[model samples]
Target: MAKKPYSNEADYVIVGAGSAGCALAGRLAEAGKQVILIEAGGPDTSIMFKRPGMITMIHSEPKLKKKFDWGYYLSPQEHVNNRRLVATRGKVMGGSGSVNGMIYVRGNKENFDSWEAEGNKGWGYADVLKSYKRMEDWQGPDSELRGKGGPIKVLENPDICDAAKTFIEAGASALGVPVNPDYNGASQDGMHVIQENTSNAIRFSSSRGYLTEQELPTLEVQQRGTVSRVVIEGSRATGVEVIEEGGQRRIVKARTEVILAAGAFGSPQILMLSGIGPAEHLRGHGIDVVADLPVGDNLHDHLFMPMTFAMDNSPHHSSAFYFGKALLKDRFKPGSNFLAHSVFEAGAFLHTSLSQSTAPDMQLFAIPWSYPPFQDDPVRLSPDKRPSLSAFSTLIRPKSRGTVRLASADPLAAPIIDPKLLSEPDDLKVLLEGVEMIRAIMADSAIAKHVKEEYEPGPGYTGDKLRAEVIKRVSTVYHPVGSVRMGVDERAVVDPELKVRGIDGLRVADASIMPTIIGGNTNAPSMMIGDMAGAIVLGTGL
Candidate 1:
């Protein structure tokens, strides 16, 4: 059969049904608007996407993630021995939120305050807190800070392995901080259970929370609708050109506005494809220049280096066995099914003497299990059972920046992603301190008896050797941002209101627009940006 023509029009044409697109489309539909949410990837109903424990399978097998993962590769990082790393962005409906390790971190309060201090008026913590509340359906304990009764239910991952008990216990004892139950509550400065995007063991992704919860006649979705470019007329973005699943190319017009929620890498790639990037580069690609604002420049992402310790313990069970138990033994229970939620091992944040900032420069991730990332990946340690409890000190505020450039004019071709990790000399120093801090956290006496030995850099590694180990073992925590950064400055791609600079009837609301990477996970904050964008389009005070 010949391909059916795509819908040519909608009041709002939103690109990429990732976290931001789903949230924005839902909000627009709620207000009775015709919205088109186009996704390049497939749906999220498969068995692989549901079971959280299958993450091991989803990760170990590249083919399993290919359907939902963009799976982009980075250019040789000069900092990490010129090694290329895989940057995983979700290609499916729920986007990365559906595939990620459901760690719902709201970032440090100072991260947003820094955004406001950088000339973004409405982006301060006080300004976006209400918007954050509007998007969250938090079911956790009573707290004045966390939102209540909204979409996207938040809960602590109940499937935490027995090793997490040691992680939290040791973290609280060593760091001199209490084992705070709610990290999203009063403050985000202590060791706590990993808050997740699931109510039970079931992953409640943004797509599940916003798009799949209810069907509205106002909202329409075109899965596998790969967008080629935003069709620009004069200075306005009037529509988008896309190649549908069955090799049919069509234009989806926007009557009022066109929004780009295609995430950090994708949003920039689409902009450059539409001739809204560096003029000289667009000419090189034989494309007419629409707006020559620095589109792909100023890219940055959070980096984490882990330190795993071999453990002699076991409380492991097959997910199939637990899923069966959940179906039979614990019927009709809300959070009883351990197989339903992501394996949220435990997490924390720490400070080093090198940083005088109020907010911690180094973030820590303590996991009960470990997968050896490198032979001497001191970051990733393991046991004979490979049941190792690990601590990862993620660099929250990174100074090094990179770029995203078009590899080819073809819409299907992947963009060149160069996240110049640890490019700055100070970045190395901060992370070096972070590694040492994790060693200290693990060295706490409260739970010191169960350890065997430090595998990498055990007795001799020092100074430059230690720094090299930290650099070589580093990998992206899967948080990329700032390619299409927002601000009021000359270099800003979008204004504080998320309006793309030098273009009308076009806006970008996603993690891409963040002026800087937030101190925590980007999923919740990206949804907040989408909610704010909806308010901006409707002329409501955000």
Candidate 2:
């Protein structure tokens, strides 16, 4: 590993240079406060990080994925055939924002309003929307609901495939919903073309938008360093103990604050490692307790099952030759690539029959290309050569919950993650309904014309057999949240202001603080949390 002189002190020390970390660091530095952002992974240099088409390939190849992904595995889930599902999180400079599908969604408005209703003040839809607009620079259709000039560049996907468009239209007709031009505006329901946080064709991750693009002289980024624990003294966070890439230990001091933006999994794991979790769990690990809050409880994620079809007519710009050409030119000229935007360019939100809130219960994604089937053995996939189109059924709100505990006290050791997916009967029931809804849309005349055959769950599958197949195929959409939840309740790890309950000068700004998981992709919401953190710390209103 190459070595550089690392900074030992700053006004603010932020662990994890992910979506939230980068945004918060940028804002604080712009306010003339010296900030140090620490990242566990190296710099983001892979071509796969810049080209949107290469994201699917990264998921397919294990060796390529390990280059930037944490590649954590959940403990065996009994309800879903005791399968140990794979959880992919970006370990690079921008974190998951650099490696994700690049889909931009603010989730449902109700998701935020419910936070206020649950006793988290100043966190309602109206309050959070100001932060969203403050950070976003939307290039989509003109609307008062959308923001124009901000750091994060969000634009409508211009490369929607014919197959995806057809699927959206057919689904809208089958579900009696309109083809909404911008789901991020007005309402979040109906079939719609989604947006991406991209400038031209290159992905504009938080590192790019906030760190690299901004002119902040006071911000210093420390990469390839693992934060072992927060250094707390007298019920106040003063700094962090880090293991550098060269295997040297050092303590970095923060004069004002220490913030953890290490995503849902990493934040709680770091908290437990710092001896700030449940009293029994910390004592069992032989660590002195700092706080006895439920730091790792309420772990939940969205469940997804994909339905694929072999297309008789090939979708234009989906061939191997075009992908190769796009990869070569996409780095220099942005939109020249056929896969300029994300592969999952269009999706829909629908209220299932069992929806308990005003928000939609399920979200669907349309993919013009076929991906490899899910398998636990080897956990590596080979891309299918056949021309195909896939629709994903995602249960956004699940009743099932689990926990994140220490595999051991080692900071570098992987955390024991048990999402306990499909543990609740209602979760399986709603996921089944989502799968059937996709099947109904595919059976329609508009989309059936392109279908050669039903690939995964076979056309003959029905009733009990179909239910069994859903169990076999169900997996994570990779949108995990609510691990280190924020609230006014006793179990909450962080307060409404993102401050740790019993620890001063410490805060959490990431997906982990979501009181409840949002109803859409988590990357955008996580960045919004970072934006809000900066405002709160600076005492500036959005």
Using lDDT as the measure, which candidate wins? 2
lDDT of 1 at 348: 81
Instruction: Rate residue 458 of model 2 by lDDT.
Output: 76
Pairs clashing within candidate 1: 137-150, 201-340, 201-341, 306-379
lDDT for each residue of candidate 1 in 144-238, tens digit (9 for 90 to 100):
67788878888777657666777688878877877877767666777878888876556777798888886778988888888899998889999
Off by over 4 Å in 2: 1-4, 313-325, 329-334, 375-379
Clashes of 1: 4
TM-score of each: 0.92, 0.96
Report RMSD for candidate 1. Answer: 3.3
Q: Write the per-residue lDDT of candidate 2 for residues 288-342, one digit (tens) a residue.
A: 8999989989999998888878876546344456677766776577667555778
Query: Which candidate number has the best TM-score?
Result: 2
Tell me how candidate 1 scores on lDDT.
0.79
Off by over 4 Å in 1: 1-6, 317-338, 375-384, 456-460
